[model samples]
Target chain A: MSPIASNDGMRPWRLLRAALCVFVAVCLLSPLVVVLIISFSSAPFLQFPPPGLSLRWYMLLFSTPAWMNSLLVSVELLVPSSILATIMGTAAAYALVRGRVPGAPFIMACLMLPIVVPGMITAAALFGVYRGLGLNGTLTGLIIGHTVLNLPYVVATVASALRVQDARLELAAATLGAPPWATFRRITLPLVLPAVLSSLLIAMILSFDELIVSLFVSSARVRPVAVQMWSNLMGDFDPTIAAIASVCFLFAFLVLLADLALRAGRSLRLT
Target chain B: MRPIDRRIWLLLPATLLLTVAFLGPVGWLLARAFTFPQPGFQNFELLWQRPVYLRVMGNTLLISAIVTPIVVLLGFPVAHMMAHGSARLRRWLVFLVLVPFWTSLLVRSFATAILLQRHGVINSFLIGFGFIDEPLPLLYNLTGLLAGCVQVLLPFVIFPLYSAMARIDPALMKAAATLGAPPLRAFVRVYLPLTLPGVMTGATLVFISTLGYYIIPALLGGARQQMVAQLIQDQIATFGNWGVAGALSLVLLLATGVLLALLQLTVGLKEIAR
Candidate 1:
């Protein structure tokens, strides 16, 4: 393709475009960087160009019983919810792609409803329903809500992976005297394992980061870290909040590195 | 009887879970908008008669309207650079965008508060450089709300626009130049129209997302900047008013649905999946 002819007259427009891109990039990244820096500050309150840096805030975060309990609750919630979502979502995706299920598109859309609807609406609805069933303010309620919210991600990712793989391999194994389960275990699962693992990590992150649904269903004793952060934000501007936020950022960074390593040479697609 | 596809059994677990835990609850809540505390239209009437409810709804719409264009304008250049830039630049841009996208909303909002508070980094820098005598009231106001929103929602617009721009044929631009069209004129006429699908899809996503925001407004916004989502939460938590909460939810869902329908009509929803 012939490049748009570069000339002296186009210099100003090019400069303006480049500047705008740089500004947007800084705006996108600066908040996270600032948080990372302030998490190390020794000051009790938020301060810029911090006088001295120390790990006091992080130490406080770990020592506080409230923060520790919320951390435990978040782990307890995300583990079961993410595992359940991944398993069910993988099966559904495989069935839609290969099983020739009737009305697959409609089913897919139905499954995506939790995400398409606003989180606040879902939270209120779940709260109202749980009131009758006496599931409100319980760990089980939070886990169930997070699973529904995260299911769509797993389904979307695995479905894309399955669509890209060669279905003929499974068919070939079947024709070679292998049963359906054997062909699936030997051929299909190995090929899509990376995608399955990636989606599991994504589901876990989504659950850990979830706030609205957890806020509605969880009690003081069953709160996630995000809800805890919200309550802390409502009261004060302590640097301890910044410390916990940095811990969250670090968790996300590690997950990103793992995801990139898992799909090394493949083009990244965020679902 | 004909044998059914055994593979269809795989769909059972997910379907059962969604139907029982998700659809049943959300559907029951929406149904309460009309039927709760005795079946009648009183809830909708209450929303109409009370000026506060109507005003908050109006404010939510106004905030979303303001956010939509700013996100699109800021997102356009970054998306363009990513679509046409060198491989190294594209990779860096993608990394920058995804890192924030994956980070928790709580973390980002907290970070934004740190940077925008009166004695925070930005204000300190301005004062240290002798730009102003008094610190600006940046946090807990409209400016703070907009900053929080535009940062989080930038990726929503950028990715869709990048996908649209990458599909454009460069030859068309060369032809427009050869035919004596100026660069600006060529972009306005030939390029912008082609990117309409992407722009519309991204703008719609941002608008709907802004309408449902609870965390950002709670943290960064002042009393005057209250949105509908917070109102819904307050009703349920403070008053134990499921009827009013359900009614507010209905209004929010209707706004989202109407916009989604319009987007589907203009550009199929599949473009968003792309």
Candidate 2:
């Protein structure tokens, strides 16, 4: 198709359109740019275009006990929850994809219930149950809650990957005298490992950033970084949070990069 | 056991986890709503009975309605540009959208706070330029809340629409032009209808998510502008009223279900998910 030629009469209209596009792009990206700028500011108060630059806020984030402890709690919660979610998710996805379970669509939707339901309801509900079970204000409770939230991601990714896999490979392994577990371990797992890993990274990102559930399930002793950040935001407009926010950005970015690299490697292997 | 039967065991672990952690808890909350504060439908009735709760419900709907169209209007041009731009430009534009999409909600809301605060970036810049005599009340208002939400949700709208728009056959527009249709008329007739699925998808997503949003409004909106999620939080966290909170949640859930069903009826559920 020939490109639509901008006639002489349309030149001003085209120029205006380009200007509008540029303005919209700037507006959309400004907040992220502003966060980065404020993160490096030396000002104790939230200020744009810092009068001076210093790494002290970043340093302070790591050195302060409250922030540092929350970070440790976050990582502690993130690792266990992601691992748990990935494991459960992989198994459930395999069953759904390969087992040919009846009503799989409905079951998949049921599993995704956490995603659709508002976080406030989930948080409050978990608060009530955890209180009953003596799991409230505990790291285990946080891990369990986060795992439930993360399970759907892993299941979705791995189930899709499983959909594209050849069942014949597993059958071939079974025909070669391998047990069911052996067939899965030797053939199936390796094929789907990349999707599983990608889901794991996503689960980690979600767990690290999760706040509402953590607010309800966690105590002062087991606070996640996001919960801590939320309180700090509510209590005071702390600029140090800008440094912590930057760190959160770095974590999310790294996980995304890892996910991309995994997908790329999978594609390369396929080709 | 049969092969399928044995394989069903694979789902057990996850089912067990979900049953204990998720389903059980939410069920408990709903059960408590009926039984805790003298039972029956009193709590549900309170939703309609109380002016505050009704106002919050209205506020939630109003914000979602406002934010959805704003995001769609603002996002249409960018998505259009991305669909039509050069490969390099498309990548950069997609990156611009993705960075915010993946960035922490807390950070974005915080950034919005800085920009919307009395002496924050936008205000200060405007003041420095002598655009205003005094700092405007941007934060702690609906304007600030909308600013935070539209930015956060814009990418969600743009992406689905961009995918749909990119698949459009540009030749159809050229054909319309060859038939003596004006450019504007051709675009309106040919391109717009084709992108309806994307528009519906993005609008439904932005609206549904906006209904449940808590952080942005909590941080930016005025005390009077409390949304449903905040109302639920207040009932639980502030008032410690599980009964009313659960009732409020049910209202929100019903609203969400209706929206999803409406979208599903128009565009298949799978398309919207995509």
Candidate 3:
């Protein structure tokens, strides 16, 4: 570690490095930024550099029936499904990490099965599972499907964080007359809160952008924005889609940014 | 807590979740694939009945094999550059690597369509450069599909390698150099072997992901270029054959699971992720 120095405090080198970092970050984030730029373009066609910017496209989004319906569908599913996934995923994370479970690693792998499993399979599998239960094309089915898909994030990330946590802390509290529930509520909950919040944010973004599963299982009730965008992209290149994508991109971006900000705030508070 | 009591009781829910929600469904899906469309291995019949299905599967495997190597080739240098760079620079590079990650997959696919369309940017640029008389056939074809998928999947391979290369001990490289190995040789012999786990991780990650990628192929692939995922989709949605759809889905699931198990055996997850 000592082998490296901060450029021996070389100001010019430091400045160059800072510039390089900024350039790289911009390049990496360019796609999202480009979408944002194109989304606000006032023209009726997609172009790199816009002649002018207006809220007309966004206005189009609000006034249009199809666009509004898709947005509504996205929200309706994301809100409740995120909640369910958080609870179930968090419980599963706790069991996998803290519990004296047999074959913890295998369980962790199973929890992460969705991420590793192709979405096509999950789509197909759910098509089978959801149909057998009479939940296919219904909100309940979509919830079950989304929950299973997004649960991996909450479990994997939170469990990794929990694995580093001290087991003795809760035991100490218990010895001092704190009840099991109180110990969890006071200590474990707060510590894992950051992971939980970020997980929720990421999961919501995932369910919102998810296309394959929705393509299979969903119908008019929850035909998400992604489906609309996919259809438009396939059949025709509509400028309104660019606009809708821009808004969806912005909405998802804010959620992720807020998640990062939230994590930062927690670390700051802790420090 | 007693070991057996705590372990068994606590794991009860996890086991049930795995068995019922994940594995049970996945296994049932695979069984459906074999016995689908009136039972007795009719789904596997696609392997022989439809050469197009086999061709598509081959195309899927071939494209991934192509993409994986290129991803590794391109990703390694980038990862190396970021790993050895100053922390300030590396952090920014990392942020750059992650930026496309947060964007919508569908949006990227659309952007790819716009980029690769016959009269789109690439053709426009080539025409401007006076490279060709006419626009090249790009999007809605295999060339465009591969291009779009590689762009999205590049990050998967890169991120894992970046993390792995970052944690590597610089001293080992220095040690190799001290023993008279040149920097390039030292990197090839010393660094590359250590990073094999990352390579495997990245490859498996991309292979498994590219296997199920729907948006990229749907938005970019031509009529003849559709992958298994799309085939399954069409079978279920357009053709209205749940049994066939169920069957094909199982094929992909089993293929992916077997590959994943192979990855674990080859790379050993503990070394890379942990």
By TM-score, who's the top model here?
A: 1
Residues A1-271, candidate 1: write the lDDT tens digits.
3445465556787798899999998888899998888889988888877779999999999999999999999999999999999999999999988887878999998998888899999999999999989999998899889989999999998998898888999989999999999998999998888899999999999999999999899998888999999899889888898899999999998998898777863444323
Worst 10 residues of 2 chain A by lDDT: A1-10
What candidate 2 gets wrong by more than 4 Å, as runs, is A1-20, A175-177, B1-5
Best-first order by TM-score: 1, 2, 3
List of chain A TM-scores, every candidate: 0.96, 0.92, 0.86
lDDT of 3: 0.75
lDDT by residue (tens digit), candidate 1, B89-149: 9989988899999999889988999899999888999999999889999999999999999
TM-score of each: 0.97, 0.95, 0.89
lDDT of 2 by residue, B56-160 (tens): 899999999999999998888889889987989887887777777777888889888988888899999999999998999999999999998998898888989
Interface RMSD of 1: 1.3
The digit string of per-residue lDDT tens for model 3 on A1-271 reads 3322222544564465456445434434555555677778887776655678977778887898987888888888888878877877777787777666767787777778878778877777777777778777777777667777888888877787677677788778889999867887898878888888889898898989888788778876667788777777767675677788777777776886798788787678566
Docking category of candidate 1: medium
| Model 2: DockQ vs. true structure | 0.62
Off by over 4 Å in 1: A1-4, A265-271, B1-4
Between candidates 1 and 2, which one is better according to lDDT?
1
Candidates 1 and 3 compared: the better one by lDDT is: 1
Off by over 4 Å in 3: A1-30, A265-271, B1-24
Ranking by DockQ: 1, 2, 3
